[model samples]
Target: MRRGGAATRPSLARDTGLSKPTVGQALLDLEQDGLVRPAGRTSSGPGRTAVLYEADPAAGHVLGIDIGRGRLRLAVADLAGTVVAKVDEPNRCRSASALVRTVHDLATGVVAQAGMTLSDVVKTVVGSPGVPDRGGRMLHLAPNLPGWGRRGLLDELEAVLGPGLLVENDANLAAVGERDQGAARGVDVFVCVNVGTGIGMGIVVDGQLFRGAHGAAGEVGYLPYGWTDTDSEGWTPSTPGILEQAAAANSVVKLAKEHGVRNASSAREVFQLARQGDACARAVVEQEATKLAFLVASVSAVIDPELVLLVGGIGSNTDLLIDPLEKAVREISPLSPRIAPGELGEDAVLTGAIATALRAAQDIVFDRRGENLVTQRSGVNA
Candidate 1:
């Protein structure tokens, strides 16, 4: 189905290395199950016309939700992996209950826009901020969304979305999204560093996600910065992490303030000032680039990826930081990997979630069909 819009039986058989009879049987079964439909005929030469088949777009649907710190994004896609509807809104829900309700409502809204209902959704994948503990009870290392790490959070989400819901780290999903469809496509070894409200990384090695034991592989925020207490009082030895304390959005704002950049409330504003030739803001940006370069060096030293993708709210500002970051990496590390901004921007996580959900949905559909077929054969044997 992914090869093209439509294909003939002989073409599918040739492409898949399957016998023509086997291909015919599989197509018949799919057609019977309403997953494939005839799409007219094509004749190459003087031979008889061959009937072409295409996947039915309405066979099943999957849902992808990205629960970010400040926004909620939801997307609905058909079995063919085509997005039908997407919705994005401000994330004002602070408490766990409110977050759950917001997700449910947003999902319903998007599915409705796609002419689907909750029951029509075969599976759902959510991309969140933190790592889920064993048994999926609570998330940890997520400070951006308040009340998100409470116990039974996954249960609450499953209660609303059904038993087919799967949750994954947002940064990891973004990396997968980039590798599958964005900047890192076809790259076997790469690291996706998301530097926004906090810092995290997604590591891909040998064409696969290298999630270490206990799922804490890419938690780069905890890297020791060795900064003295006088540098920033906000982060101490007992704080969440030093790298995040020095490089995240809050840290950027604090740096700007310390540099006497008044009236710059957000990191975005600080970047704008830097672009306008403000000396103080430029200094802050330079420091940020240096810190990020160090982070990249640490990653390269350990994993030696072919490329490093800078993503998230602050990291994607490549126009200002890319050149400096590349130069800094070359200065500090022997392995100078290609560093670039993520192409998908905020939509990376959502796209990854959708891709994951679609895969799960396809597995479920095919497994059920296979099970039914086995049961029918058993009955005949009996």
Candidate 2:
């Protein structure tokens, strides 16, 4: 369907060894159902012509929300995966109702801007920075935002959006987003490690986001690798943890200060100094890269992903860490995954949420059509 929906139908039928008339009829039915529409005429050599059609962009709209540490981003996209309108706002306020209201208002504004209405929005997907259950209760503690772990967050969002709301962890969404539209576009097995305010990983197995039994499969932030604030022999999932304290922005700043570098406030500052060839800054970055490498190698030993996408606040910008990290990983593991930065940057989460929402919309259409077909078979709607 991506290759000029109408013109490719005959080709698809030929490739699949199906009858051209059957494919033509199916396409006609799809167009009548409002899922496909004539796009335009395709130009060709002398005397040859073909009309093109595509998936109807106006079939419906979907809303994607990415709840970041300091900001909330909401976007409305068409059926063809184009972002028609967007809204971004600071999320300093901690009320769940307020967040839902913000999403509702933003979605409404986006729809209006696109000359659509609330009814046009088929589904909504949210990417929050924690582990949320199917019931919408955030468990396993969000590192950046406080009070996000409480239950009913999904229900509140759904109550405002009406129906079809999906809540997913930010990193997991980022991983799928990258796989679908960014760096890992054609890869099947991969993992995306988001190294920003904290470290988190999104695992993709067989081209799908693989959330383990407890939905905490890629919780790299809690992966204890012999580093912790308190003296302990073994570190468990319930431990205080070390990734956030050792490699996060705040940790970078503190480590810089300990090395007599004063007033280094953020990770960007540290990276800038390192770029300028400051010995202390270079040393700090190298140390952090080593730790990150060890973490990745450990994950690879278990998941054995083909590629690893690096995303989030620090990971997106710190491509310099790759060379050193790769070398470090070679010492611990025989297999090294191809590591790359996410092409979509911070937008990965938003794009992924939109993809998820679009999938839900497609499911809705299929289910309703199936039910209608059943009714017709029974002479109920006939």
Candidate 3:
């Protein structure tokens, strides 16, 4: 519905089999309200150049917030889905109320940087590490954050930011973000899996994000499968369990202790040691890759997506994952989906939030077109 990105009304009408007059009228309605504008005249043919209209990139602004385990991000974007400004900082709040307040303050600063106000902001989208209710508030069971699943969280957000705000799972937003303006541009059905301090997935089907009943469809981190002692045929049972629990940056640090590799503080250091031919580090990475491959295989069997987009701090590093992950999936499934690292890097979720807000606002105009046509037909009959 947001017309700025691609295609024109005349071309759209031809594709939809609708009369040019109908399309022109719809375009006029959208333009009158400062939503879309005449960008320029098309140079196809001679008589009269048709004026091309696009969604006005400056019509309104949107704010996106991604709250992670130890960090918080705030970004302001235009209708063109371009991030205009952003802020990232470590969260110092200990309670949900304090976090909400901090977010509100950050939003205010972001808007000011964008040379706008809350009234100029069409909407705000927040992405957290847990499932949000249908109404887009109150995270339910975000294990990374203590006491996050309590009730009234939505009410609190509304009370602080006003209303009509959207809250989404970070992985879900990452998936949507990738499809909208990131690596999975033409992919309609794909799963976006983020590997970081924790693991999670976002499912996109039929060009729309598929949020299951209760809004927690892609919770792959707690898939409940684990590695056991002793090798069993093709699969190594005793190697490691879920990659997030065993190979995540945090997990790698924890696993290092068991190997008597003391004073290793970060996942980066573990990878560095592996490259240096440290026995313990190579074992850790291989063990992690094997577990990840199994998880990818399971996801492929269930989703059968065209592609599986890997993201987050760990998944984006294709140098470390692509080969082993591909091999693992091929070992079990014949129809393995193409695996690729995230293209948008860390900004995928932020970009997705802006796209989400723009879609909601633009859908308003498209929804009215159908109703208006029906009314006109009824009037003509009368």
- Measured by lDDT, the strongest candidate is 1
Scored by lDDT, model 2 comes in at 0.76
Q: lDDT values of the candidates?
A: 0.86, 0.76, 0.75
Error of 3 at 245 (Å): 3.2
TM-score of 2: 0.83
Sorting all predicted structures by lDDT, with the top scorer first, yields 1, 2, 3
Ranking by TM-score: 1, 2, 3
What is the clash count for each candidate, in the order shown?
A: 0, 0, 1
**Candidate 2 residues 128-210, lDDT tens each?**
87778875444455746655566776677777776767788888999878988899998989999988777788999898888
Off by over 4 Å in 3: 1-54, 135-137, 227-244, 260-263, 275-279, 332-335, 364-382
| lDDT of the structure predicted as candidate 1 | 0.86
What TM-score does structure 3 among the candidates reach? 0.79
TM-scores for every predicted model: 0.89, 0.83, 0.79
The true-versus-predicted C-alpha distance at residue 277 of model 3, in Å, is 4.8
